[model samples]
Target chain A: EAGVVQSPRYKIIEKKQPVAFWCNPISGHNTLYWYRQNLGQGPELLIRYENEEAVDDSQLPKDRFSAERLKGVDSTLKIQPAELGDSAVYLCASSSWDGYSGANVLTFGAGSRLTVL
Target chain B: AQTVTQSQPEMSVQEAETVTLSCTYDTSESDYYLFWYKQPPSRQMILVIRQEAYKQQNATENRFSVNFQKAAKSFSLKISDSQLGDAAMYFCALGEYGNKLVFGAGTILRVKS
Candidate 1:
């Protein structure tokens, strides 16, 4: 059983450029989340997807940031006209309920580190 | 809204010693979940341990354990026999089913050999 997989472990982009990160969640997991972690800070949720539907994305910057989970298995997060402040580690996590445990535990991937110059 | 706080920005402990990391959370939801995640230099977030809000018993995994105080809204992680491998950034998070995590600022733990 593979864990949540994210591609491009590290990315570098100039300001005003466009960048994207990809994530492939664990098999049979229905809930997926994208979070941004700045240096010395904890991860902040940017969006959440339940299958093909984005149930929560209020924290997402609508102007420049966009995300999609087309077939419900993989997800893509894009940042157009990236700014220096947008540089951070983008983390993807997935979780599901196991009947035995009443809690939903999440497994995270090796995040994509984005550096915007 | 849920918020998690970790007052310590960084901590250090000698190898083979014990260390305790403190965390406080504010949430109205009673039946939620709390977690401790470790991110090493590799940048992969790993689950260290978790405690269910409704469970009165503290959660223990090997040398890692959690002191969960539901009434006080405090969840602390105690690492016994701390090794060099335990050095990392530890984050305290709170979440519920169908919701995303609310994480603390994180504490960087340093192990001195």
Candidate 2:
């Protein structure tokens, strides 16, 4: 039983550059999520995907942030022309959609730390 | 809109002692889920414990337990016989079916010898 997997555990980029983070959810999980966490703060959801379709993405900065869950198994979060304030840890999580029965315990990845200078 | 609040920014307790972290959330939904996640230096979010809104009994896991007050919308985590390994940033979150989570500002716990 492998947990959620993320790549580039650490990333460093300059402001105005483009950066992307990747996530591979647990096998058979139907729901995926992307979250951002700033220093001293909790993780905030940027987007959510039910399978391959994005069900919620209101918190994402559409101007500079874009996300895709092509096959729903793996997802990508991108931030182009990044800003200094964008420096934070990007976390990905997944859960079964049986939330109604209280089966939505999320399993999270180690997260990708993005440092925008 | 639902919101979660963690009043304590940081807390410390000696090993083998007990400590409680406070959290409060606002939500209109009658049925929801509350969670306590621990993020250590490794940066992985680990579920410490969770409580369902409809459940009256508090949720307990190993040495971690929660005090859920539905009427007051308060959820607090109590770590019994705390260990140095318990040091981490603890986040309180609220979510309902098909809805995104609303998280608190988080409380950092420091376990001292």
Candidate 3:
């Protein structure tokens, strides 16, 4: 009954530097998602992956942010040339739902806090 | 585009008292789900309670319960006998069938002993 696991609970970087966040979802989970939370704000979806395919990623910043899920289990989100505004918490979540049952219950992991100077 | 709103930025509740967190959402989809998530200082989002739009019964879990008004598109969380552990940032989120969850700005709850 292990929950989703995320790495580097904290990260500090300077502007223009590249940073990456990792996520290991719960076992047997079919859907994975990445969210970004700014200070004093709720989380916003950045991308979602069903197995090896990214089903939704409309909110991801294509110019500097990219994500990948290999083997349909673990995922990695990368931000190149990070900006000062990139300082935020990156959250990872997983769900057992297949996106058809009219229920999408997600379990989240301890987010990675990124600080860009 | 749908949106979730939490007018209260912060609230305080005395220990052993009751407090209600208000949330309102805009969704055209008739069938959807509402959720309350608690984020502690650890930065983990934990599901507190959820209510399905189609269900008439409000969801209740331990000291947590939700008053869901589908017609009015309002979902509020009520914490009875609030404990110090209840202090955190609470987020109201909405999810449609097979769609992303829309989250509000969140409300910070302070518990005074």
Evaluate model 3: give its lDDT. Answer: 0.94
Candidate 1 lDDT, A1-117, residue by residue in tens = 999999999999899999999999999999999999998899999999999999999999999999999999999999999999999999999988856667878899999999999
- Candidate 3 — number of clashing residue pairs? 0
TM-score of every candidate relative to the true structure: 0.98, 0.97, 0.97
All candidates: DockQ: 0.84, 0.75, 0.79
Query: On lDDT, who's better, 2 or 3?
Result: 3
Interface Cα RMSD per model, in Å? 1.0, 1.4, 1.4
| Model 1 per-residue lDDT tens digits across residues B1-113 | 89999999999999999999999999888789999999998669999999888789999999999999998999999999999999999999999766788999999999999
Residue B40 of model 2 has an lDDT of 91
The local lDDT score (0 to 100) that residue B16 gets in candidate 3 is: 100
lDDT of 2 by residue, B35-65 (tens): 9999898769898998989889999999999
Question: Which structure among the candidates has the greatest TM-score?
Answer: 1
* TM-score (C-alpha, index-matched) for candidate 2: 0.97
Candidate 2 chain B, run of 10 with poorest lDDT: B94-103
- Model 1 stretches astray by more than 4 angstroms: none
Each model's lDDT comes to 0.94, 0.92, 0.94
Q: Write the per-residue lDDT of candidate 2 for residues A7-49, one digit (tens) a residue.
A: 9899999999999999999999999999999987888999999
Please give the lDDT score at residue A46 for candidate 3: 99
lDDT for each residue of candidate 3 in A1-117, tens digit (9 for 90 to 100): 899999989999999999999999999998999999999999999999989999999999999999999999999999999999999999999988744546889999999999999
Candidate 3 chain A, run of 10 with poorest lDDT: A95-104
